[model samples]
Target chain A: MPHRRSAFFISDRTGITAESLGNTLLTQFDTLEFKRETIPFVDTVEKAQEVAARIMNSADSDQHRPLVFSSIVNPEVRAAIKVDGALCIDFFEAFIGQIEGELVQRASLTVGRAHGMINEEKYDSRIEAVNFSLTHDDGVKLKDLDEADVILVGVSRSGKTPTCLYLALQYGIRAANYPLTPEDLDSPTLPKMLLPFRHKLFGLTIDPVRLHNIRTERRPDSKYASMDNCRFEVNEAESMFRQHGVAFISTTHKSIEEIATNILHKANLKRRF
Target chain B: MPHRRSAFFISDRTGITAESLGNTLLTQFDTLEFKRETIPFVDTVEKAQEVAARIMNSADSDQHRPLVFSSIVNPEVRAAIKVDGALCIDFFEAFIGQIEGELVQRASLTVGRAHGMINEEKYDSRIEAVNFSLTHDDGVKLKDLDEADVILVGVSRSGKTPTCLYLALQYGIRAANYPLTPEDLDSPTLPKMLLPFRHKLFGLTIDPVRLHNIRTERRPDSKYASMDNCRFEVNEAESMFRQHGVAFISTTHKSIEEIATNILHKANLKRRF
Candidate 1:
């Protein structure tokens, strides 16, 4: 049996960077099972002390030393988190010195700038993309289809909506999705509304069994969730994409981030944020 | 003026971890402007060679050496990215060996597990949260408010929608948001629909000036976008939050991640994924 290790992702801001970096490294060691916790917004020394105490307590309770991934910027606060009984990987301390040396300049040592609210332009664009995605979701608003960075077309439960939302929320891409209904799937040609914007159209396809599983969770024991219907829709959608030369991805074994990033690369769309 | 530098975030998978970690580190050096690009899915030796060529070309064009932040796991592919004239910071190489030594196990050397599709439960939960946030947006579908992990309440354009969406997408939290309309803001008490869910309610406030800016972009010259209306709405919303003792954060200079993380900590909500 694999040993259970406590892992801490500590940051003065969102802690997302710490968490992502830590998770990326941890995946390399498949032999261990990790119990994870994220401690965000540890900007002050008092908060740092609390985080240290929490880490120490968890370390004491655990058989193995806790693994801590930290991205704290303030020297004072960063110093306070160097608790015993844990292997602390201070990402800022590990890399910032090298970066500063390479650039031949001193870092500002400011806290919260990495994920702070200071950049209004970037923030507005992200919010704008979010609004655009929400307004145009599920082909609700089709008049401004050309304005979308990418228009995802697929049958229901093919992972169009989540991929679109991920593109908007993560990369600030103005993504809109058009669900290919049963009628549309049966049609010999592409939908009329999508022809003009073919270059911006991307398609998503999924395995019939996986689609059935997803649809069953939403609406069980119905024709819409039936295996036959899922297979038919997926086959038709994939053929439609191939016939029209629209770039597409299979979402069966891919994460939303993977699908979105692959679509952006294949569609040659630049992320706004 | 500070020199401009070309920055590349390279990864074997989606490049999100590389980009995020790089962006966080680069924020400390505010003096330099970066011409940034993310090269995702560099899982093969040929792709690595192409990325290396691209980086070298950018380095040739740039006055300063390009900074490359990479999270490539494949040793063969990682070797191809060690291009001259670019300061490559290989995240995996820097820390993975130490982690392996600490764990006393060999790494899987897998290409795409960090943000991969292996975890179906976590992926499904994220999609569920996205669907939940969409259905319950702007106080819609309020009958099952108890199902929400966090309920965001704010006035129009106070950033309730994006924050809720972020909470859902990033943390897999079922976040529903209610916009505090003029009618709701005019009253001294909280909305009746939110009374039963007060424990899960998290308010969002923004500077009136910033709110005015955001509203003006959506509904230009309208009463809701006017400065006086913005001021009145913000003041009323904050006062109502205070009167109701609802936990709130100002969205003026904060990112959606910042706002969501703070709310999660304050509300004591657990992430589903």
Candidate 2:
């Protein structure tokens, strides 16, 4: 290492995991500057070969023997890449034996769970697509809406922020969510500023009992997290979604992805990203 | 059908794709209430069966049967899910047939390349563990920078935003990135805010040539996008990272995931969400 470490993350799939893992370890080796790169979707041998050549060429030019960590799916392509002479750490090779052994030993029904259940864009789009669309007034600047893609109208803690950020980070859609206060839920009219965009309005409703439990996790034994109040708010929000023609999703047992996707469908909108 | 039609999104994975398609179609229907739900991690028959049961139960209790869509990888799991009495759709199912046909017509590689990689996290815990920290700092106050599991430092367009957002969204790390401007570069000093947290300071840099190209995409031919300036700034930033004893990652060709992971590795962080 020449006062700097050039690092490469070559992945067969999206490469998110490799990048995340790599970033964490690099901080320890303080004396070396880490020059990083990611080659994504390297699914074929040709692609792998091209990457190898690039690394080899880069190594020759840069005086550092690079540390490359990769997650490639094809065995032949991986073998071809190994000859490129970099310090290669293969995630699959290291884990496969362990995973295979576990699978054989346990014979468990579960294979594995997908990480976080969605890409950044698609995830964000879902959250942004389903918020207080029916209530926004005309001439409101996009930013003034607190950067909401679609503001969700619902009782407290119906999974709005998590869903909205999921939409933004996953899909590059700006989604801002505001809880429907008890007054907003009870009244026939919505927040005056959101009137024009009611057409895009979506709502969220969860079983009161479930909502109570979820809120309890955040702050236990508060009226805001009350089971009776949650039930009332959720039911009222459902009524509001119906009366205002605002589409909504239930957060009862569904994951964030499901709720976001449902809202997108209801709105008849494509992903913003 | 009720007097109104709402949007619906379903996912074997996350119902993002289905929502995308539905957002367009819901407009043709009557005034609607949106409804979204998902069956998380539907990669196994047991998970699929659980999802099907939930959908059926929801349908029986509600007047309208919710629209369902999903992305499931396993064929058997997908089949098991559709047995529920819902207007269900599988996202990957749409492409599975095509992939199957392709596999049948042409020889497919048996082992995927990603199989050989070592599990760096096994030996490298400090960095790998914290690559993904929770975002949505709803709880983490800004004043608490020193308390952060990791903090990212870089100049604008140096891959800070996406990476931080990824950490926040995927790993639930409360990530905050600060931009280093020319004045900071000129002084040969770390930012005053960063001096106390020298151990937490991590830097992100890019190949000025590549940075110039990326900036050009956002604002063509602007001074900010000038290649020479980018090169100057990059050189200076790298020096700062080194002089300040801060580890850095060059994001010349890295994706958000790669950059985020690199940041994570150096930070000794973990996803709290």
Off by more than 4 A, model 2: A1-149, A213-223, B1-11, B15-142, B209-232, B265-273
Model 1's CAPRI class?
medium
**Native contact fraction (fnat) of model 1:** 0.77
Q: Name the weakest run of 10 consecutive residues (lDDT summed) in model 1 chain A.
A: A110-119
Error of 1 at A71 (Å): 0.6
By how many angstroms RMSD does model 1 differ from the true structure?
Answer: 1.6
Residues A1-273, candidate 2, lDDT per residue (tens digit)? 344556787766555545533443343233446678866657678988898888887677777566676655456777666744567765444443432342232212111111222233443233233222212322234446754556666776676655664555455555555578887767766667667667656778877887787678668998878887788788777887787777777766555545665565565544464
- Assess candidate 2 and give its TM-score to the true structure: 0.54
Q: What are the per-model C-alpha RMSD values against the true structure?
A: 1.6, 15.5
Query: Candidate 1, clashing residue pairs?
Result: A117-B253
